[model samples]
Target chain A: MFGTYLRRELLGRRRQTIIIAIGMALAIALVIIVNSVATGVRDAQAQVLRSVYGVGTDITITRPVTPPSGTDQGGQGARGPRFDFGAGAGDASGDGSRTVHSSRLTVGFGTQTMAATSLTTVQKVHGVEAASAVLSLTNTTFDGTLPSFGSRQQGGAGATPAPSGGSDAKGGSSFDVDSFTVMGMTPGGRAVGPLSATTLAKGRTLAASDEGKHVAVLDSSYAKSKSIGVGDTLSIGGTDFTVVGTVSPTGSDSATASNVYIPLDVAQKLSSQTGKVSTIYVQAESASAVDSLKASLQKALPKATVATQADLAANVSGSLGSAGQLVSNLGTWLSVIVLAAAFLIAILFTISGVTRRTREFGTLKAIGWSNRRVVGQVAGESVLQGLVGGIAGIAIGLIGVLVVNVVSPTLTGGLSSGRGVAGSMAEGARRTFGGGTGQTGRFGGAFGGASSGARSAAATQVDLSAPVTAWVIALAVALAVLGGLLAGAIGGWRASRLRPAEALRSVQ
Target chain B: MYRLKNVTKRYDAKGRTVTALNDVTLEIPDGQLVAIQGPTGGGKSTLLQMLGALDRPTSGTVELGDASLGTLADSRLTGIRGTEIGFVFQGFNLIPTLTALENVETALVPLGVSADERRDRAARALESVGLGDRGDHRPAELSGGQQQRVAIARALVKEPNVLLADEPTGNLDEDTRDEIMDLLEGLWRDRGLTLVIVTHDSAVARRAQRRLHIKAGKVKELA
Candidate 1:
């Protein structure tokens, strides 16, 4: 009887049911769209970071290159590759010009060097699964032509000799300086360093046997720029090293740790910093172990800087970060306001329907229907209306999610750490894990649930996408049902308060 | 089988007490066809309400068999109304959303009857009211006289001992009114029900075996 009566009422009073359902549907759709978009943005930021930080890097350790005070650098530190030229350094040509060539490798400007023993200390730290150290260096080559003053004087009639051993006596001088970044690693195949997030593009990767062999691997982008390939020779600090292979970052927008990669021992020797490393990447055994390990690592290496992925996330700047803030603030409030309004609409409609049916309910009570039965019937109708709305809302919300994915907007995120690890993961996450490969997901357009997010030294441009999951859909349905139940309860209470005699009397 | 002594029902309409039933004492025996006729604003409908156990009189002893109608709890009164009394309102008062059959089924719903049994009995009640073929038609789809028949069927479906009709044929034409009266008379006679009808129409009152007149909350026997 309850089912039949409820169905008939809903079908008979079609307008009320449709109106309530539509209100709920709109609220549900908005909720779905907002939540999915927020998740997508987070995923994009993570992808950017993964390109630079490598997949499993839970912590990064570095120190700043503090310059000596009271110098001409004026407290800001050294500007760049400062070169020293000695007299008679270049060869003189017939054109009265002197050509000079020199190259030097030094620690990168922003980062400091730590002892090689620190890597072992990090490895010994409790909860540390793996650790890798890198030496970041800038190789600058100075090649120039110097002017000769003596040549012009010697060409003049009755000219006297002006200089004894100056290579630029003829006085025709011009010079060119070139620079590129270089990183050195141990070839231990650890899952916590720059190589972990890269794929070998050609030839072979560096092996432990290449420790002091003067072998080098170029970043694919850097190699493309230099037009150098496998078995080619590139000069670093005046020494020609054999290029064994080339590798590229796994993430589309991520950059390699440096322009050139080489064995740590060789990089240390070439840079004249033999016992030092500029950066360390550490992986903890589990997510729960990261905080304690970070504290331990900080205690063990007092001068070194330590940062976790979560901490790095705060350094992300630009529209991606703004989107996250917007989602948490405006989007949440909008959803709440709309949902409350929808519930109010449903409740009002239900109560009014009960009012309109006063005669009918009075007649039922006169014919022996109990108050409980009448209230149940009214509530049943309301709940059914809500369930209908819930179903329609799910369909509509999914369509909204689809639209967002199809239009996949792009957001730029940059980390502000001193090392320029600029791919700060800013906005969305569902594909929050990191690995060496990625594929766009179907339901959410999320890229690589197992691979994305971390910052290198450059900001990354990433596409935002929403995720579609069973739990999210279930949550929508639950919300719809809850809204319906609330409306029904209020309406039923009104119905329950109706006295059969007064209700019937009011009809006239 | 029913008795009322000094029954007084008062209603506070806008801060002043208006007496709906004032010092009314009456006795209605089993299987009697009683008609109560009165002018507007009289105690005729209030008398019917007291008889039907729909309310508690302020100062009265109303009884049906051994049960005291005036002092029973609301739930107990409701139970008695469900099992022993039936009501037919003047407006037909059919649930507009339901068909004639579903309207009749409502009376049995409170009886805890099985679904199939309720359907079977509701259909039979409609048949007895000459509306078996019209069982599937909603109240709005039926004529004025037909809607009243559905209401009658709904009230009688549970086989109550007392049948109360309040201005049942008030909205019908003369011909339909006579037809509905004949149907009610026949059913009362066949089932030996204690039938009570409140009406203003002289024609409807004239057909009843017993007649009473109420004016200004006072009741007087009518010849």
Candidate 2:
């Protein structure tokens, strides 16, 4: 009997029911899209940080130096040699005179602040599993003629094809010298940060036996700049070294930052800094021992700066972190506002619909239906509508996510953190976990190529890759049903309170 | 059976009190065809509402069988109305959305009868009212005479002990009115169900076994 009444009432006025349901669906979809994107970017950031910081290495110790006045600690206007060591590689630029700015060149080895001797003392600290020091040699100019066999690189004046009608620096006619970084790492070095050995793009990483070979493993950024690849000969610091391999940091913006890497001995000998390093990368035995390791490292080398993974991620996120927080908090408030409006509209529609059926309700009441039964009938109908609306909303939300991805592919995997650690962490996680690898694939067209240019753009730009969990769907459905029931209860309460005689006598 | 003692029903019309039923006393015996005649605003409908447990008197007691309606809870009154009484309105107040058979079946819904039993009983009641063949037609599709028949079937399907009619034949043509009155007379005689009919036509009231004339909220027996 109840089913009969509900079906007749709803079926008789399907247009109105559908209209209300759609309104509720749109509200739910809005909530899903906003929150999903926020969560997706945050997750991407965490992954990128993990890759940049390395899966195993947790504590990083660097030399501390006072920045120039008016410089902020978050890698802004802090341009001295010491501050540049852990910073993302700065961009290279040239004036119209074709003259390169030497000061603006990316500094790979800024001042070798941490002494090379500090590695031994750091390893002896409690809770430390292993520690190695890597030397950064920034602004090291390379010869104009290098990697002579490959196609010219893109972006810089040296690589830019000359204008067809112009007399200036025609392609291949006037070569420009560019500054690059050459990181010198110990064989199987653990201090080189999260650039895992497994993420080797081409050929092999440096081994301890290749120390004297003058062989260099160029990071993807420098490799792309010089068109250098495996088995190519590249001249650095007036010395021609064979490019044995090319490596890119897993999911890191640093992939485009670090220029070249060579054996620590070669870098030490070339830079004339045989016993010094800029930074020391430390691996703790376990996650629980990270704080103790940092404290110990600080006590042992009081002048050196020690940081944990969280600190690195936060520093890397910088502005992105602030934006992410805004989006997250705003999403909650927006959902609340939209939900309240939806509920209000739903309640109004229900009251109107019930009021229109006063005659029918009077008839039913007069026919001996108790007030409880009448209320139950109304609530049942509303809950059914809510379930249907919730399902439609989920579909709409998923479609919204896909549409966003299609319209702006750059939003997929474009987030980067301060030191490119977010990108690095994402890349590293992609390799180690295999799940986030799909997310990085979205960066293929974003950077204009699959493996061309600087994928480091992806290091700072996060993408939406968080899977829509069951909990999100469940929450949406529950809210929809609750909204409908609330409206139904109010309408039913009013309907049930009408006296049958009065209701029957009332005008339609 | 119904007993009313000094029953008075009042209402506020604007700022002043208006009496719908004024200090009325009446007793209605079982198995009797009673007709109530009154002019407009004479409270015949109010009296019928009180007898059907659809309204309570402002003062005094109205009893049906052994239960005093004035003291009973609203729910109990609703139960009594569902099981012991049936009402037919002047406008043939059939739900327009329902077919004749469905209209009749609704009377059994609140009685907790199973679907099959309700359907069978509603079908029999419609057949008894001569609307069995018109069961599938909605009220809007039926003629005035046919709609009234469907309304009668709805009231009779519950097998109530008392049937109350408020100007049941008022909207019908003369011939249809005579047909409806004949049907009501046959049901009262054959089924022994008590009948209370309110009417303004003296010709309709002449056929009843007893007649009550109401004037300005007061009732008197006409010999």
Candidate 3:
């Protein structure tokens, strides 16, 4: 009897029922899209970690008690003078004893020189596999004096000096400004680190032959912005260099900010730092070896802080974590809006259905049907509607995700590519079918690929998973059903409470 | 068997008290058709509603069988209505969305009857009301007289002890009204069921075994 009642109600009110179903489907689709995007971002982040950073560094080393005195640190306090090499080296106390600590070492180069080089000795230490050197240089300008059409004209130069402390007369022309961090890599460093030569969007990568040839690679973003490209000549620190390549933008702090890459030997020679170095990077043979290697390095170089690849990646990725969280929070707000809309639509449909069926309920109650039976009939109809709507909504939402992937592949990590499609689809299927078993397998695949590729194409190997899409779909359906049931209950209650005689009478 | 002792029903509207039924004492015996004859606003419907367990008297003891209607919980009253009391209203009260047979079978649903039994019983009840071939027809498909017959079948399918009808033929023309009256009389006589009908029509009141005239919320025996 309940089934019969449900069938009659739905068939009789086909238009209303379809409207409710479509409302639910749209809500579910919105939820699916939001969840899929979040999942994609998370996957991409993990991929970046594995492919570029190699399980990331275990620890980071910095001046343990360096006062927060730099403008970059958001501090306004007076800073100690820029690292003074000569002033700090021979300081002695009054009792004829050296005051400087053995662990503290300072070295400097003139405006025409590079800073330091102690990395090879660090690599020779036990448990160290390879090492790379890094230098932090600011306020240095590249000379692109040759007129390029892309250069923007600054307001006619006044007698005022440039903010970079360089005089306009000294090739500080508006077109000559290029500044970024520079790091030197060894063969082993190239194999163990996240930096990749293939990420070059334009020119050839740095080679052994280019070491003494005064060649450099520019980041793609900077190259595009500055209208510079491969084969372009740039003069840095009174020396000329040819732009051999343009690297793809990492969109990360390091990549977005980096403007050039030159051979470590050439950089050293140009900077006049024959035997001094800045920082040394040591790569462990495997993830498990990180701890032992750290211990051994700590024992050998008691003064130098030993950091693993994991530690560096964490530091770099940490800077972006909060921004990602903000995006996720916005997505959550959107989901709430979608859910609230769904609930309101369900309620409206239910009320309309109940109001239209007022006479029917009155008749049923009049003919010896108990209120319980009436409520059951109504609720059963709602549940059936909800089930149909939920299933249909899920299907529609999946199609929506597919549409988004097709229309804007770059927005979804280029997943529309043949390789990306195969990988993502397989991952999506694995998640759908593998249930609990798939999590580990999927993570292993993503993590393994990331780790192996981190040193080669660090920027392109982001992890891509689709579990969030499934979860969102599930949540959307559950909410729809819940909303439906509640609407049905309210409608049924109202119907059952009506005075049968009053309901039968037509209002004047 | 039903009895109402000192049953008084009152409504409060905007600080004004109107009595629909005031201190009415009545006893309705089993296997008899009783008509409540009253003009509009004379509390006829109120009395019928109280008897049907659809309303509570403001102050009274309404005893139906061994249970006091005044003391029964809402759910318990519903159960009583489902099992022992059936109602037919003036407008026929047929669910427009359901076929005549489906509307008749609705009463049996609360009885936990099997689908087959419900269908068979509904068909039989409709046949008794001369609507056997019209089982598949909805209320809109039937005439005023036929719709009333369907309503009568729906009320009778439960085989209740008391059948209550409020202006059951009020909406019908004289011809349809007479037809509905005959159907109700036949069902009442065939089942030996107690029937309480509230009607303003003297023709309807004349068919009942006994009649009570309601005046200003008070009941008096007319015959």
Candidate 4:
């Protein structure tokens, strides 16, 4: 009887049911779309972090970038790689005139060195599953010609040679400096290191057997740009290393952490920083233990900066950050307002329905229907009405999600390991070189050069997709039903309060 | 059986107190067909409300069989109305959305009757009221006479002990009114049911076994 009566009522009064259902449907659909988009944006942020920090690295420890005190910037000595050519180090193929090539290695941009023993400290922390240390360095090769002059007889580095070799008669000489990032890693600890998020695109990755060997791996993009591949030799800090492999980052349009990768021992020895590491990547045994482990590591090494994946995600900038803000703020509020309006509409319409049915309810009450029975019928009708809306909303939501995914918008993100020291590095260089023929002056890099902090920022483009999961659909249905139940409860209460005698008399 | 002792009902209309039923005392036997006649606002409907257990008296007792109506809780009164008393309004108070058969089945809803039994009983009741063929028609599709028959079937579908009719033929023409009265007379005779009718028509009152008149919330017996 309840079903029959409710069906007849809904079919008989089409306008009311249609209005309520449409209202609820639109609200539920909005909720689903907004939630899915928000989740998609968050996932994009995670991808950006993964591209920078490597996969499976839950926490990263680095030394904070402190302000420069006096000549040293970022609290580090020397802003960039310094090539110390001794009195007899220059090639002597000619009398007081010759070609000279010198290479030097220093800490990479946007990074600061910490004691290599910090990796051991991190490993000893409870809940730490694995730890790997990396020494990020910048390799700069300076190729220049010494003019043929009599300056070698007077002094050293700044001597003006005679215009006799590799220079015009006017004593004009040109020098070129080329630089790229190098990361030193444990050959066997790729599970939570700089190479974790990369897939070998050519040849083979660094093996444990090559730990102390002068072997290197190249980033696929860098390798392609330089036209260098496996079996090719490259120079780092004046040492020749055979490129054994090329790898690419897993994220789309993202760059690997460094241009070149070499064994930690060799990188340390050639760079003349044998016991120094710039970053330590740590992985906890379980995801839930990451925060606690980070806290303990931070306490153990108070001077070091410990950051989790969430903290890193906040550092992501560019258009992707804007999208995240839009989703978190506008999308959330708009959906909330629409859903509230939908619930309000449902409540009002149901109340009006009960008001219209006063006479009918009174008649039922007078005949033999209990108040409870009549209220149940009203509630039942509303619930069915809400269910209809929920089904329609799910269909509409699915279509909306499909359209969003098909149109996958591209977002550009910029991820940096730490704050850049380029401005300070440039200032420090001017103070040191006094605007003379500085090796890192012209081709410093995109952001001048973070010679002091060595901050490196990589820009990546990602396609955003709103994924609709089963749980999100379930929530939409639950919300629709909840809206219906709320309206029904209020409407039924109104119906139950009607006095049968007054209702019948009012009809007259 | 019905009994009313000093039953009084009052209402406050726009802040002015108005007494609809004043100290009305009455007794009605089982299987009696009674008619009540009165002018507007003369407490005729109020008296029916008390007799039907649709209301509680302000100052007196209304009894049916062995139970007192005024002192019982609303839930208890609802039980009595569902199982013992049925009301037929002049407006043919059938749910407009329901078919004549479903309208009749509503009377058995509070009885917790199974769907099959409710359907079977409603069909038989409609057949008895001469609306068996029109059972599928909604109230809007049915004529005034047919709608009234559906209302009548609904009222009697539960086989209640008392049937209260408020101006049952008020909306009908002379011929249709006569037809409805004849049906009610036949049903009352065949079922040996207690029937009460409130109307302004002297002709309809003339056919009842007993007649009462009300003037200014006061009731007077007529011979």
Predicted model with the maximum TM-score: 4
Model 4: lDDT equals 0.80
Off by over 4 Å in 2: A32-77, A80-193, A196-198, A201-217, A220-338, A405-408, A412-468, A506-508, B12-18, B37-42, B170-175, B200-203, B214-216
Between prediction 1 and prediction 4, the one with superior DockQ is 4
lDDT assessment of candidate 1: 0.77
**Candidate 3 chain A lowest-lDDT run of ten:** A103-112
Report the C-alpha lDDT of model 3 over A316-388, residue by residue, as the tens digit.
Answer: 2222333235337876687778767866777777777778777767666655567777788877777667766
Stretch of 10 with least lDDT, candidate 2 chain A = A438-447
RMSD of each: 8.1, 9.8, 14.8, 6.3
Model 1: iRMSD? Answer: 1.7
Rank ordering of all candidates by lDDT, starting from the highest = 4, 1, 2, 3
After superposition of all CA atoms, the RMSD between model 3 and the true structure is 14.8
lDDT of 1 by residue, A146-213 (tens): 65555555666776644332233434344555566677888656467878878889988988788888
* Candidate 3 TM-score versus the reference: 0.64
Best by DockQ: 4
DockQ of prediction 3:
0.36
The alpha-carbon lDDT assigned to residue A36 of candidate 4 equals 93
- Pick out the ten consecutive residues of candidate 1 chain A with the lowest summed lDDT: A426-435
TM-score of model 3's chain A, to 2 decimals?
Answer: 0.46
Put down candidate 1 lDDT per residue, B117-189, tens digits, no spaces.
9999999999999988998999999999999999899889999999999899988999999999999999999
DockQ head-to-head 1 vs 2, winner: 1
List where candidate 3 sits over 4 angstroms from the true fold: A45-335, A366-370, A411-468, A496-508
Docking band of candidate 2:
acceptable
lDDT of 2 by residue, A316-413 (tens): 34345654665668777787888788788778888887777776676667767788888888777777676667778889988987786556333323
Chain B superposition TM-score per model? 0.98, 0.98, 0.97, 0.98
Model 3: lDDT to the true structure = 0.60
